[model samples]
Target: MKKYALNLIFVFMTTAAILLNAYSCFAKDIAFQSSVDKNRVSLGDDIILSLTFTGTQSIPAPDFTNVEGFHAKYIGPSTMVSIINGSMSASITHKYVLIPLKAGKFQVGPVTFKYGSDTYASNILTVEVVEGPVSDNRPIRTAGVPPLKFEDKIFVVMEPQRTQAYLNETIPLKIKLYVNKLPVRDIQLPQFAHDGFSTEALDRPRQYEEIRQGILYDVLEFDTVIFGTRPGISNLGPAELDCVLLEKQRRTGGIFGDDDPFDDFFGKYTAYPLHLKSNQVSMTILPLPEEGKPQNFSGAVGSFDFNLEADPKYVKAGDPVTVKMIVRGDGNLNTVTTPNIGSQDNFKVYDPQFKQEGNTKTFEQVVIPKIETVTEIPAVSFNFFDPAKKQYVTITKGPIPIKVEKSTEREGLKIVEADAISRPLVKKETLGRDIIYIKELPGNLRKKDAYLYKNKLFLLLQSILLLCFIIIVTLNKRRERLKTDIRYARRIRAPKEARNGLKESKKYLSQGKIQNFYDTIFGTLQKYLGDKFHLPSAGITANIIDEVLKNKNIDERVLDELRSIFNECDVARYAPTEVSVEKMQNTFLKLERIIDYLERQKL
Candidate 1:
């Protein structure tokens, strides 16, 4: 009986020791920590802000009122329990999706939370809100559909052709939209506010596809010219682009909830407004040199060719003559002026008429010789600073020679004769009759009753002729399409080829010949890309395809589909794996979709 009592005592002590150890573990110091998925993020991007409580499982939600510059929402709480070395510990993490409102550096938390008898404040986290989304490199995983990633999908970038330039020099700026798999619409043109530079109006947006970091993206490029007005550090911009994205919507609270298997198959899409912005770009504008400056420089800053010419080299003293001076080259032609022709006292010079055609400017001046003694028009010189040569160049043309003759038509003609020493004079007499003048008008004006165009019958005939002309032109274009245009013929036949290829692929798929099916699909794609881009089949590589279609402005979704089909084909052909019928069917459907899309495209 004593031994039994001792065993009971030992059992009670063991139980008490276990309970105390558990209690000590629970009573340990509560550790509060806060973190973010990324330290820097764009204004429209989402940052996962988390507050974790360790050493306890009964944690109340953290109060995140201290988070600044962002709108935070409590997503939910996740609890994790683990047993390490026979000790049980737990951690509760509260996640908040933080959407930044403005761009700047901000702080999140020092969030305070309560668990049992202890109060804990999380560590502070610093985040930077930039102008665009942070780049995410993780591969996307999807069950049925191709994986789509936010970072690879759609974004905007601002780039300059050159970062350093001289004052008043032209700089090419390109703002582009990069899209991978997103359906975008209602795209408003990008805009930016530049303080120290003058920008030209953006030209039409150009569409193309580019491969960046092994991912192909459809790029919409908008080009503009900017010139720095003053010397110093000049800013380009924080460009902003606005568009709408058609994204899949998550369905909730119905027979078909998120967990429903049919959700991925029959998903509904909603239009979400997306605003993208690019970071500001800086440029250094160096001041033009002050040395070797010309006195007659007219602020011209590019290469130019100068010439001078005069028409009607021989002219009466009082008659008008035209002298033209032309300067042509690539530069700011608007700022160019005619060179000064010194000393106008020998002639009467009218105000010069200036006309600019493209990169050439002509100055036409009307000059009348005031005296017969004047021999030539004075030489004209043009001086300008050539930035390329880094020197002042003075271009001088010839002093055009002119023969000035006395005007005989100013007054009646006069005849004079002179004899020296002794002279014999003979007198002659002649009789002349006065010429008779006509009394009638030179030409008869025969009047008609009505104009041919004013007649109703004539107008009806003309309309009929115009209708016939339109019909004939239309028929001629159709005939030309059938006979002369090879590209048109190819385009017309492309759909038929695609259908035949699809039929062959379907046959192979039914027979369970995976290699043959993928090879056929691959060949079809190569042919399609080649046909659409007018490229050779042998040269149809992924990079070559991207290059060929870069200027075609194909849609991002179509490009993504093409890339996925290619990748699937490559894997099925080279890798030794069991290709499922469902995957082959998906690939076939994707191919059909791509073919249909390309057929509808204007390329």
Candidate 2:
């Protein structure tokens, strides 16, 4: 009886060991692995958390009750069956869409499932929720991918080459738009407010493709050059772009098929106004070194080559000679001044006429040699701060040799005049003489006029003559005042100038020169106001007109009409759009009425 009991115990132990080995082998074949589409996701962005089970198709749906910090939704199951070496294998992948409620790191799994009396637990997945959407090209599962959000598909970036720069140094700035599967239209060019810098836009935008975090995106790039005028921290942007998003219109079918005819008649396009702006970027601009600054530097900060040339090497005294000075290279050529040609005592140098084309600046200066002894033109020197070399460079050019001959005509005329004045007077012999006889008669003519002088008609004629003389003198004094007093001259000529400009504009209007017509009309009004108010014509803006006319007892209606005319002209000039003929004519007439009213005003 004892042997039989021991044998029974060993058989029971062997059965238990066999069962445990079978369960271990089954567990090894079946894997419950959890993975996420994206390890990092933005708040409000949906994440795909998939629990994949291989080696068996009998798995139950995963329990996501323990998942926290996210709204979880079951996205149905995807199954794949494969036959390898005549052995059938299957996988069941259960997907859940998880939208993070807040920005934090959260775990998605350890999802438990029971199959064949065995509990299988998937690996826990750690997901990081970021503040902004992830810019990546990761493939999104069909069931979990959400609709494209504006912040996700399209964005603007204002990127500067460097955030730190020296004062007056050129900073290359790039304003770029990244697009991913979004259609846009009616795009207005980007703009930014650069108050403290000298800014210049480059050529038109360029299109290209770039990859950001595994996502391919179309990029539109705009380039610009900026120079910080002052030293300190300067804010660059908040670059703004205006565009219209072209969204696909949904087709609506009536309760009865093919019944809605109105839907077909209407265009199948919908546009949403989208204004995109980039974040502001700050730059630290350091002031240029003052220790080695040249005294003659005129705020030039670029690489440049200086050249000086004279047109005619030989010329007569008192004749005009042109000195051409050219500055060529890549730099801020707009602010470059003419090189100091040294004291031009021997040559009368006028102001240099500056002309710029591309990277070259030419200064055409007219100089007249006064003295015949001057053998050479003065040496020209240009001083600039070379930012690349970090030093002050003085470029000295030649004392160009030239032959200056005395003007023979002037010298000869002077000698002749002097000789004529100093020569003694020659007495010519008097060959023929004429004799005249004088007679004394006529006493009867004087007595006849004595009675007429006392008549009333004669006194009346004399009074009329004196009145005419007084009128002539008053008119002469007024003309003199108009010439001497600038304010009075402008006020007097304003009306005539406006009238002339309007008449000229009519010809342009007749020839379909819309731009010229608007320009003429705008200039006429601006000049009329400028002269009447004694303000600078160049400084006359819409705001200035309003401010100046506000105090003048002008009618508000007239002011409004005037401002409207100015605004229209401004739009036409700057925007250059098609304008109607009737609109142009009406604007002309309104301007005339405004001028007439302004002329009648007391002030």
Candidate 3:
């Protein structure tokens, strides 16, 4: 009896211990977060505000009554439910998204929330409102120019041939580096953004003798072509140049065991500082037209000529005819519409295979001969408008002739079914069968309901569609919220974008295409700038970037690092001296480090 009692007690204790362990492992039921635009806010200027929370239990919303010198605007609230690591968890964020109506030296009182009978309050936050510039309390230095480098005054200008173009239109964007008072050494083309367009270099940079704005300038030009994707507006920014400026500076240095304190602070020292800066250029984007467009219109842009032909115009009815179409011109040949082959009663048509060649400026294609058989092949025509001539041109083919021939004789085999009248059912006789035998009645035949609701598969499909519709609606709403909250969206994707350029550069190097390798690098960096500052690359210049960075509260050290990396790439690529493979490889590796460091840092 005592042993049985002891066993029962042990089992009960084990159960209790297991329950306690499970309860202890449970995640905290509440989370807290707070954010504001400026620690030292300015009066009359709006400061953004936000709040975040996570919990499993239902919690009452907090009150925002009688908050001093602060007004709150309730943009909205959203909840995100997710299963993380085999555990059900949820987060409900209540955003104030406030724009302060008035500001002063004030304290925002602790926010109180009720969870069951317990109350929780956030810590009070103090803010100072000032009228003058929000002092960042950082030293300001002149944009430094690196010594022994031609980059201090050197810069790049990207002039796109056309900002507005059709889907397959050839865009010849020219990048010109205009040498100012500084001597001409070399210039290189930066990388580009690849989304929504296909790109190819027009030609190697060419040197030209030219004068601009009453001054003789040594100019080098590079060109490229871009094919827009769809009928929608987009922006292409200018290719940025990072030039190293060689500037001389005097500074004080320290020595080991120096007795003089003044020598330690301002010991005379001469050193050259490398000044770096990233410059951006912007271009306008225009969407292609879709309305009144032809069904078979290929994505061809620019001017072109069309020709149709068929080998062996005369053939037997059973023999196939090969109809070929050749489109050649300066415009987009790859995207040309399929030629219309006139329909005939006795003829059957098949789709033609297509092939294309050439870069952006000049594209060429040939549609393989479409095979078909006919009693008589009729005339075919193709029509298109000529922009340069300002008139319509229509090309036509002849009404080809075909001959019919009787079939060759076969010895023994015979076709079973020819025509309904040609075949009659063969009758068979069964002997010794007196009484007619009836098969047992088949199972009951029931008519199925045709109504949509009665179809199980249809109902399931409808439910899936409905769920998709709900998801789309939710996504649209979230997009609107993100648009309104620009800062949040930028924080998520900016780092990845910056790192993408350097990573792509490595790939190009592995492929052993030096020019393309550099191009990818520049393109990636330009994309980062656009995403970083919310400005199109076309409109950004070194001066513009410097100004924006100043406004962004970025430190001089970070800016210097950015400038140095860009300068190294530009000078190395375009310098009059040839860039060795070893030097290029080294620079490529350095660029990776620069990008990684920039991404890990906060601006």
Candidate 4:
């Protein structure tokens, strides 16, 4: 037993020595270098610049005071510790998102840092800013130079190809978002209010850069088609869009070191939500003209080409021949109808099959020659109103000749179901089997009720329909209440928000971030109370919360707990010092319990 114990001790000491030797390589070289995610980026595009310290995670971030051609925003620091092949190494990387302001090739820092008696300098990083948008295949609409508005940072515009269009004529609509040097994300689809018109859904937007008044702006355009439905003056906008904007702002005081030189560079990103609305567009919708209107004219208001083709033109009598009618061009093909083969003496026509792809619509039908004398197919006319010509046009095609040979097949006999002579049919049975009277049933047969309400399947289907209607009504009412009832919506959102805030506070606490923890805690309590009482979060104060809850006969102990937390958060955030982990845990628990108690109250 003693020998085994000695062997175990010897193994443990050997392992410890190996681990220490491996980890001692962490600070051996103390090398610093800089790199970027992209060597080439488009103007107004974002690139990441990283300063990697290949020595230790304890090094302070170096200043990027000489970053050219791009505005630098310090996001955060990342640390990595790895043991590879019995060698332990650690590194700290500081990352910055660089938004290019101009088009040029620029060099980023040879950043220098001093530690102990040694100094380290990072290598320079070169980045090229291309003059246009990122590589995308979709072509952007750059014809209209939209005037900048609202500080020229961000705006949206809605423009139509023409202000006036004939009824049933299609107009190309463009909705564009111009972002000039502003960092934006989460762009929503624009809502275009097009009354007195029919519209197609907006397709995927094309992104590119356009120059306006000697300034470059990033453009995202949505192209869609719309047509006037009725003749009159119509208004078509107040186009609305929502997006989130990112702006660099000073940190609202965190627990991190205040004397750090990189604080300004490491400023926080604040999101400002924006709703952009474009002006309403008023335009005249001209009615279609009445002169020289074709008798069979349909509302097809664009240029089009028509063709007719027949296959198996030499079929025998009673054999089928397929004829295809194709109409292709820049028009609403939905309004183009199949041409009728008009009255033929010895031909039978069947319903045609229709297919549409891109700008073409094709109709195919099978016509059988009933007799061998059918010399040709009849002619049919297609009529449409051309908005460009402002007149009606009619195109006629057919009289397609074909060879129809008579079939040599034998004829079959036809069956006559009833005798042509109407002798008393009820009393004329000569066979052994007795026949029932024509006008009446046998006495043994029972009659069935023809009322539809007696059906079980019908009743079941109606019950299911009624249940579905009730469910839909309930959901619709709930949606409307959420939209219009502010207090109710807030009350519903209170618990989820409280949970999220507490979760964030707990994360900060674990990270040893004292000021952030207090700030999150304080904000959480404020938002919770504000939502619970249906007040603004910005106006919520400890005293106000106390008054509000006290009026509702809240427990004094709960109020005292709330007051203590609020005061602690105030003190810790403004005059932040060391706060114990145990204290933070206790504060978190108290906050959670108080929130639970308040939520349980009817008020």
List lDDT for all candidates, in order. 0.73, 0.74, 0.53, 0.74
- The deviation in Å at residue 128 for candidate 4 is 18
TM-score of each: 0.44, 0.43, 0.33, 0.45
Best-first order by TM-score: 4, 1, 2, 3
Q: Candidate 2's C-alpha lDDT?
A: 0.74
Candidate 2, run of 10 with poorest lDDT: 258-267
Candidate 3 to native Cα RMSD, angstroms: 28.0
Model 4 bad stretches (over 4 Å) = 1-151, 252-267, 411-603
Clashing pairs for predicted structure model 1, backbone only: 207-553, 208-550, 209-550
Candidate 2 residues lying further than 4 Å off, grouped into runs, are 1-149, 252-267, 411-603
RMSD of each: 31.7, 40.0, 28.0, 22.1
Clashing pairs in 4: none
Tens digit of lDDT per residue, candidate 3, span 435-548?
A: 677879877888664665765655655565556556655765565444334334444555675566677787777777777776576656655664565444333334544756
Could you give candidate 2's per-residue lDDT for residues 499-549 as a string of tens digits? 998999998888889999998998788778867876545446689655668
Off by over 4 Å in 3: 1-153, 180-189, 194-196, 241-292, 295-299, 344-351, 357-603
Per-residue lDDT, model 1, residue 451, is 67
**Predicted model with the maximum TM-score:** 4
Q: How many backbone clashes does candidate 4 have?
A: 0
